[model samples]
Every structure is written in structure tokens, then in C-alpha cells.
Target: MFRDTQSSWMSTLRHDVPASLVVFLIAVPLSLGIAMASGAPLAAGLIAAVVGGVVAGALGGSAVQVSGPAAGLSLVVVDLVHTYGWRATCMITLLAGAVQLLLGVFKAARAALAVSPAVIHGMLAAVGVIIALAQLHVVLGGSPQKSAVANVLELPGQIADLHGPKVAIGILTITVLAVWTRLPRVFRAVPAPLAALAAAAGTAWAFGWDVTRVDLSGSFTEWGFPVLPQGDWHLIVASVLLVALLAGCESLLCSVAVDGMHGGRRVDLDQELTGQGVANMVAGALGGLPVAGVIVRSTANVQAGARTRWAAILHGVWVLVFAVGFGWSITLIPLEALAALLVFIGVQMVNLGHIRKVHGHGEVPVYVVTMAAVILLGLAEGVLAGLALAVLLALRRLTWVTVRKRDDRDGRTRVTISGSLTFLGVPRLTHELRTIPYGAAVDLDLNIDFMDNGAFEAIHSWRLDHERMGGTVVIDELHDEWYALAASGARTLPAKSPLKAPDRWWLPWAQRRRGAEPVTVPPDGVSECLVTAGTREYHRSTAPLVKPIFTELARKQQPSHLFITCADSRIMPSLITASGPGDLFTVRNIGNLVPRRGSEPHDDSVVAAIEYATQVLGVRTITVCGHSGCGAMAGVLSGGVRAGSLPGLRRWLRHGNHSLATFIETEGDRLHAGALDVLCRVNVQQQLENLRTYRKVDEQVREGKLELVGLFFDIGSARVHLVPPLRPTLCVKPFDRPVVAGEE
Candidate 1:
């Protein structure tokens, strides 16, 4: 126990201590800048940083996540300070923290993640624009106007009459920050903001420039308790809820992002929310800014190799020490330098990566509308507007339907209806139904994912009218059987069933037509061939549906993979791969074997197929697939005892002798597996080796022009596992790697 405790202490001193110092450097500059942008006392920023680090770090679920005053909340804080005095804003922060605590107790943390990311990004972008405009004035040695629009109008005049010394300092700070990351590793070891501030302060002091310095002489001495605001109750309550929800969401989102950055314990979002709540309550009571997780500090902590929450806790202690013991040092930094830092941070918040992501998801409209509304109106109103637009877009997609009508080769009309069949699409659906001839035979294919009562009635009424006019109608559902269920007098109201894959033409006829009467063979005749009956079934049910796809591939085939697998009845390559007619060029054999180029009892069949696939067809990948309970593998394991009666089978079994030897040698590594199963897996890797013996395959593989893959199918579990190729010099254990989900 003593040794373990000592080792843990050593680890903490080595990792967390250094990491805390790095985060301390980063948090101080950012916290002060955020506080300045928020129009709050400079002391409040340090107080929030200390309280956030100590309270949130000690109680939060995330191990290395750092918490402090965030730039994202500056706009809200400034507005609150303007509307209600500083003490009233503190009271509001306290109330918001209480609300957050209640929400965390109720386990509502995950619900915040359901909000559209586009809306969140837009909100942050708008806040960034506001902060940039306001701080740009300070950077130019002038006071900012009340609003973003006002600041824009006054920017020209401010630039025309800039104060030389202050502007030079601010410009120097911005230049240093912009170039910091590109500097040498030694120079960049220090945080960029801290280095920039230090450079600006040193330059100003050395040159004896007349510029404004940070005023914190009265901040610590004049601290007082928060007081209730004098405001309308309704607006006050809304303000509290907005602060609570926004702070909780940002903290939880930071926790999620931090999870992806490390291999430590995953965060409990509820606990993190509770921790942020406690930190905010403490900060507010101490006359400081609201507290939440800060991504910049957290990223620095993680990158600095922080192992536990101690890094965050220790950073807060450092902040407290500096604020009390060395308070005079902070007064040396220029206000213009901090303002320049704020402008840089604000501009970065409007990230181009986030814009590209939202644009890719087709949510650019929501993002744009939310950003514009927030900049012109307010934050809460912008969120509501974005949500309303998102809902309308969702509904429009849900009510969309498409109908395609064509004549088949058999002189029958084919009508295909797809997409959600809601009442909004009834008019288009009925119009398409009316275009069909009254007495013609029609094959109606319902390829819809969802259906409503109004859509069902429209189609059912049309089908009855057509049948009354002597037209034969056969309704086939290619997706969910919504129409069939409604036609058979089943309840279609809720329609809340889990999504189930529809029966495909590849399934057996008996399984495909479940609950339908079985087809019987004639009593006077022998058993009919299943192949003949299958082809007839395909012609009647499936051929018409896949005619277009087949037509596109009729003249030529450009399959991407040459799949070679065992000729087991249970192994369906197309079914297992979820591939269609022209996806895979397949070659099946007894043991899924690929013989060496010049081995005994040479077979040209497999080699000929490989050459044709690679040289003629230019196939990209070649796969050797094996399965569980392979009879050929079993025969090879029994030392030719199973194939003693058949000479041809004995010769084929010789090809798997190397596989048998390999399985025996590596038998100890996989004692839990059966001998036959191990041999089956080994055979796949050995076949991959045999394929590489060919000169053309080797050259192509070396040139990166072709890829070889191995697969193992478990018949009972219906799972396909990937097997990597074998290396001759270094023995690699088979079936040891993880299985990834197969692509459709």
C-alpha cells in the first residue's frame, strides 16, 4: 500500500504539477480577456478561474478538463451588466447555478446534446462577431459603442484618429499571437497569450510609452456580496434559465470533446453539470463571473500530459497565490494588449471547420438564419428561430413523395411509389394514379418507408375503383408493409414498430412469403428442381424490380472485388457482403484454396481467374473467405483419413497441409478454440500467402495497385470476421484482431 501510494504521488508530481503550471499560464490571460470583454471587474475573472478550478475539478466527472471564465459567455454577461448592475448580475448567476444543479440531479444532461449543432455553432459565431467589434475599439485606443451596429458605424472614425502608443502596443500583441504557433518548439513551449502579454508589457515599460494599464487596485478591496435585481419577474426568470441552459450545454459539450482527446475515464455529463453549477454558485457569491468548462485551458491541460483532476485543482491554487501574493504583476499588462487578445479569440470562435461541417449536413440555412438573427436581435430569439426553421425542414422532408410510372416489357403498367406517404402528398399520389388507364393491368410497387391514414385511404380507394373497371392490380410492398397491413384490416395508427429490413428476393421463397399458403408439387410427379422453381419465382416477383439496375450493367461489368470463398451452401457471398449483381466477381472451390504458382498437381483454373480479374478487369481487391466447420479443413486435420476412399479428394487435401502444420504450431496460443476452427482460420491466411506467390499479384501489391483481404464466416452466429495475411518470417496469430462493422 505504501509503495502504491508513493508511486501515485511520484506520477502526480511528474505529470499533473507541470500540467497545472501550463494551464495556469493559459487560463490567466484568457480569463482576464473574457472578463474585460464582459465589462466585469478584472478581479472577477481571477476569482472565477480559482473557483472553477478548485470546485469543478474536484467534483467533476472528467479527469483532465479545466474550467474557468469563457469568452463564449462574454456577450451575455455584458448585456446583463448593462441591464442590471454588477451585484444583480451576480445574483442572476447564483440563481442560474441553482437551476443547473436541479437539472443535473434530474439527469437531464444528455438532453442538451440533442440540440442541432448548426444552431450552437451559429450562436457562438454571433457572440464572436459581437466581441470582436466591441474589443476592436479598445484595441484602437477608443471606447466601444453600445451595440455591434453602432461599433461598425464608428469604426472608421476610431481608425482615423488612433492613439499611436496604445495602437502600437495592441498591434504588437496581435502580431506576436499570430506568429507564436509558427515559432520554434522552444519559443512555443510557453502559452501564446502569456508570451504576447509579456512582450507587450515589457516593450511598453522599456520605451516609457503612455498607455493604459490594467487597474486592479480597488478590485480585491471593494468586493461585496450579490444582491437581488430590480426587474420584471418574467424576464428575470427567462434570464436565469438561459444562463443555466447555456452554461450546462457548453460544459457538457467540452466534456464530450475532451473524452475523444484522451484514453482516460469517460466523463459522466450529469456530474460535470453539477460540478459547473457548484463552481458558478461559489463564483457568483464572491462577486465574480459565472464559471464553466473552458476548451482552450482543457486542451492545454490534456496536451501537457495531465493524468488526473489534480492538474485543474492545482492550477486554481496557483491562481489564488498569484492574485493575493503577486497582485502587482498583473497591473503591468496593458489594457490594449488584453483587448487585442480578446479580438483574436473572438475571431477564432467563428471557426471555418464548423462552417464546413454544417454546410456538409445541409444545415447552412439554419446556421445562417441563427447567426443573422442573433447579430440583429438577441440570443434566445435566434435559437427559437433556428429551431422553427429546422422543424419546418424536417416536416417538408417527411411529407415528400415521388411516383414513377412506366410500361414493362410484358405490356403491363408499373407504378412505383416511394418516400413517406403523408396527407401532404395525397394530391400528387392521386394524380399519378389517375393517369393510369382504367382497364389496364397494373403492378403497384409500394417502396415507401412510412404511411399515414389519409395516404392509405387514397391508394386503397383508387385500387378498388381500378379493380371494378376490370383492371387487375397486384400490390407489392418493397419496404414496410404499411399498405398491406391497412388493406388486411390491421391497425395502422401508431406505426411505432422498430425498423425491420424487408424481405429480399435473395431469401428462400418459403421465408419470403410467411403467412401465405405454401405451394405444393403435383402428386403424380417426382420432386421438382428447386433451381427451376427459384428462377420462375424470380421472373414473377423480382425481375421487374431490378430490371433498371440490370439494364445499366448488361453490356459490361466493372466489379471492384474478386471474392474467392468455399463452395458451402450456407455461404452466400452477395448476401453476406450486402452487395448486388455487379459488385463482386466470385470464384468458389472446395477449401477456398489458392495453389502456389508451381506446386504439385497444378491447377490452372484459379490462376486463370486471378489473371483475368486483375489484368483484364482491373479489380482493386482480392478476398479469400473461409468459414466455420469446413469439411475440407476437417479432412486435412485428420491426416487424409477422411479422404482415404477418394483419390481426387486426397489430392485436393494436400493443398491444405501447410495450414494443418501452422494450426498445430500455434495451437497453444488459442487453447479455447477447437482444432477444426483453428485450422479453418489458418487456411484463409495460408491461401493469402499462396496468392502472393504469383508474380503479377506480388508486383501489383508492392506498387499499391491491388489489395488482398481475408474473411472468416461463422455459420451459427452469422458473423463475418476479417483475417489478415500471413508473413513467412514472422508468425502472426490468426483470428486475434477485432471485427469492424461491414459496409453496405
Candidate 2:
């Protein structure tokens, strides 16, 4: 325990202390600037900073997030101050903090995140414009008017008659801030705002210019209790909710961003909200501006190597110490410099990156509407307008549908309907269906993801009416069978269920198009043949996709594997191996057998193919694949009783005599597996041995120039298992474990 404590103290001294100093430098100037922009006493900004950092940092869920007076709340704070006196505004802040505390206790933090990001971005951008317009007046050596419109109307006059020293100082401050990032790394080690403010203060002091200085004299000593405002109860309650919600949201959003900046424990948003609430209550009681998480300071804290909440808490302590001990030093700095800083920050809040992000998601309209409404109307009114528009846009997208009608080459009308089939699209759907003439053959393709009862009834009624008019209608659902399910009185699958795999051309015809009927049959009476239908499908679909590949391999065929397997139609070599065209040179037989060299009943056909594949084609690997429930193996176990009638088949059963002898010798008494299954696996090993009996195959095997592989396909489980050479134990376990040719 002692060693752990010692290590923690060492870490705090090494990492947290330096990070705290950096955050302190950043928070002090921003707090002061935001306080000035909000028309509150500069001391109120400092007070909020101290309370936010110390209180919120100690209690908040995020380890490294820094909290303080944020500029995002400046416009709202200034409005509250103007309407209700400063004391009443403090009371509102207090009430807002209590409301936040209740909300955090109830764990409603995640619900706030459901609000559209476009709405939040628009609100922040609009607030930025308001802050910039108001601060521009102070930068121009004039007091700002009541509204953003009034500020714009009086901007031309203020520019014409600028106070010399104040304008020069503000311009110098903005210039230093704008160019500070481009300076050398060593110089930029000092925070840009700190450097700008210090430069402005130094120049002003040296020149002895007559400028407005920050007056914090008696600011800390003159604290009083908050007073309730005299106003309509509805407006007052609305104001409290606004402050609580806005401050809570901004703080929570900053915590989320801070989580991405560092590799640390994720922030508990509910706890973070509670911490912000406590900090705000403290700040309001102490006659400070509203407190919330500030992203700039938090980013600085993380980048400066803060590893814990101590950095944020210590930074706040430093601010409080400086405010008490170095109060006289602040009087030397010009107020115009702080206003210039506010202008720079406010301009930055309208980020182009945010606009591009929202635009990509097709929420640009919501962002623009929200921004315009806030600028023209009030903040609350603008937010409501944005929310309303966002809800409407969502509804429109949810009920969106498309209907395309065309005449196919076979004289059948092809109508494809897609998207969600809600009642909102019923009018357009019925209109399109009505356009189809009576007695016309129609292929109705429903490519919809979801369908409602209204849409199903519309299509069903149309089909009935068309069929009664002597027209044939075939309904094919390309996606989920929503219409067919509704038609058969079965409960349709929910739209939000797990998605099914899309139809692929490689799948069997019966599985690919489940409910699709034959559009047209061939006149030659071969229409029932799957091969004929598959050829037609290839010509229409698969041929186009593989044509380029076929073109490349037109002159020659160079396959990698010589795959020899049973003549089982259930096993597709390419599908099992995940290979494409020209990948496998296949040889299929009744038993997947190999005739031994110089043996009776020798098959020259199998020998010729093996020699050609190994010597001429230069195929490296020859795989002998067998399968479960093989009829040849079953006949072998029955002593050729099934093949007794046919002389040719009885002679062919001689190839498996060696496999039968091996199975009986090793596994006849063991009842672990069925006799037929044991014989089938042994047959694969016997075939591999028969191949080695040839001089060419033996020589290549000895030289390690040729590889012989055995494969067993379990038709029931649809799994492929590898079989080792010369081993009597066929391993039927999963591929993760080792397996032998004859092990079960």
C-alpha cells in the first residue's frame, strides 16, 4: 500500500503538475474573455473558472476533462442579465443547477444525445455569429448595441470613428493570436491566448496609452445572496430549463470529445452531468457566471499529458490563487484585448468541418434552417423550428418509395416496386398499378424492405382484378416475402429482424428465387430441365460478370489442384474450395477409385488422366475426396449384393475389396461408427495407396515433388475434413484438431 501510494504521488508530480499549469494559463484568459462577452463582472468569470475546475474536476466522471466558464453560454447569460438583474440571473443559474442535479440523478444523460447533431451544430454556429458581432463592436472601440441587427446597423459608424489606442490594442491582440500558431514550436509552447494578452498588456503599459483596463478592485469582497426575478412564472421556468439543458449538453458533449483525445477510462456521462450541476450551483452562489465544461481547456489538459482529474482540479486552484494574490497585475491588461480574444474564438466556433460532416449525412437543410431561425428569431424558438424540420425530414425518408414500370423483351409488363410500402405511398402505388391495361401479362416484382397492410391490400386487390379480366399476374418478392406472407395469412417478419444474406448467382436456382414462377418456358419441352434454365440465367446474369475472366483464360487452362471426388451432384468443388473458374481440374467417378498399376481389372482411362494431370499439366496436389452415405461404399459393405444383377457393376466392386479388408481388420469389432461409414473412409486411404503403386507416382512422392491429400465431406453437416496418408484412424473432429485418413 505504501509503495502504491508513493508511485501515485510520483506520477501526479511528473505528469499532472505540468499539465495543470498549461491548462491554468489557457483557462484564465478564456474565463475572463467569456465573462466580459457575457456582460458580467470579470471576477465572475474567474470565480466560475475556479469553481468549475475544482468542483467539477473532483466530482466528474471523466478523468482528464477540464470544466470552466464556456463562451457557448455567453449569449444566453448576457440576455438573462439584461432582462433580470445580475442577482436574479444568479438565482436562475442556481435553479438551473438544481434541475441538472435532478436530471443527472434520474440518469437522463443519454436521452440528450438523441437530439440531432445538426441542430446542435447550428445552435453553436448561430451563437458564434452573435458573439462575434457583439465583440466586434468592443474591438472597434465602441460599446455593443442591444441585438446583432443593431450591432450591424451601427458597425459602419463605429469603424469610421475608432478610438485610437483601443482599436490599435485590439488589432494588435487579434494579429498576435492569428499568427502565433505559425511561430516556432519553442515560442508556441506558450498558449496563443496567453501570448496575445501578454503582448497587448506589455505594449499598452510601455506606451502609457489611455486605454480601458480590467477593474477587479473590490470585485471579490462585494458578494451577496442571489435574488429571485420579478417576471411571468412560465418565462422564468423556461429560462431555468434552457440554462440547465444548454450547459448540461455542452459539458456532456465536451466530455465525449475528451474521451476520444486520451486513452483513459471512458467518462460516465450521468456522473459528469451531476458534477457540472454541483459546480454551477457553487458558482452561482458565489456570484459567478454559469459554469460548464470548456473544450479548449480540456483539450489543452489532455495534450499536455494529464493522466488524472488532479490536473483539472489543480488548474482551478492556481486560478483562485492568482486571482487573490496577483489581483493588481490584472489591472495592467486592457479590456479591448480580451474582447479581441472573444472575437477570434467566436469566429472559430463556426467550423467548416462541422458543416461538411452534416452535409454528408443529408442534414444540411436542418443545419441551415436551425442557424437561420436562431439568427432571426430567439435561441429557443430556433431550436424548436430545427427539431420540427428534422422530424418532418425523418418521416419523409421513412415513407419514401419508388415504382418503375417497363415492358420486357418477352411481351410481359415488368413492374418493380421498392422501398418501404407505407400508407403514405398508397396513392402513387395504385395510380401506377392502374396504368397497366386489362388482359395484359404482368410480372409484379416487390423489391421492398418493409410492407404494411394498406400496401399489401392495394397489390392484392389489383392482382385479383387483373386476373378476373383474363390477365395472368405473377408476384415475385425479391427481398423478404412480405406480400406472400400477408397473402397466406402468416405473420410477416418484422423489418428490424436480423437481415438475411442477399441472393447470389452461385446458389441453386430453387434457393435463389424462392417464390418466383416461370415467366416463360422454352417451346422445345426442355423447360423443366434445370440445366436449360441455368443456361438462360447465365446468359442474362452470370455470363456478363465472368466474361472478362473467361477472356483472360481463353487460350489455355492451368489449374492448381487435380481434384478427384465421387460423382455426387450434392458436392460442388468450386463452392467447397471457395475457388473460381479454371482453379480445379476435376475427375469424378462412382466410388472415387484408383486402379493399381499392373493389377487385374486395371482402368487405363483413370491412369491416363492421372499421368496427364501430374506430368503434362504439372499439377502439384492430387486430392482424393470421399463423402458420407456413399452408395458405392454401402454396396461394398453388402458384399456387392446390390450390384449382383449387372456383371459390369459386380466387376467394378472389386476395386473396394482392399478397403473392405482394411476396415474389417482395424475397425470391424469397434461399434464406434456405422459399418458403411467406416468402409467409405477406408476406401479413400486404399485409393491413395493404389496411386502410390505406380512407379511415376512413387518416385514423385519420394522426391517430395508431388503431394497426395485425402478429403472426407460430411454431406449432412456440410463440412470438409482433411485425411492424412497411410493412417487407419480417420479423424472426424473439427479442423482445429489434427486428423488422420481412417480415424473416426
User: In order, what lDDT does every prediction score?
Assistant: 0.86, 0.85
What lDDT tens digits, residue by residue, belong to model 1 across residues 1-744?
999999999999999999999999998998899999999999999999999999999988899999989887878888899999898999999999999888888998899898787888888898889888989999999998988899999999999999999999999999999999999999988999999999999999999999999999899899789999888989889988988888888888888989888878889999998898888898899988988888889999999999999999999999999999988999999999999999999899998999999989888998899888888888888888887888787788777888988786457787878778989999999999999998999988876768989999999999999999999899887656799888889977565333333355556656766322124455666655777766755654466568889986876788888899999888989878777888888999989999888987789999999999999998878889999999999789888998878999899878898887788787843445477887899999999888889999888887877778889999888888878678632222344333211221
Q: What is the lDDT of candidate 1?
A: 0.86
Question: Which regions of candidate 1 fall more than 4 Å away from where they truly are?
Answer: 1-4, 402-419, 427-443, 447-449, 462-472, 478-480, 488-490, 504-569, 572-655, 658-744
lDDT of 1 at 278: 87
Q: Write the per-residue lDDT of candidate 2 for residues 257-360, one digit (tens) a residue.
A: 78888877899999999998998899899999998888889999999999999999999999999999997888888989998999999899898999999999
Model 2 regions lying over 4 Å from their true place: 1-4, 404-416, 431-450, 465-472, 476-511, 515-744
Q: Alpha carbon lDDT of residue 734, candidate 2?
A: 44
Candidate No. with top TM-score: 1
Question: In model 2, which range of ten residues has the least summed lDDT?
Answer: 735-744
- How far in Å is the alpha carbon of 560 misplaced in model 1? 29
Strongest candidate by lDDT:
1
**Weakest 10 consecutive residues, lDDT, candidate 1?**
735-744
Displacement of residue 149 (Cα, Å) in model 2 is 0.9
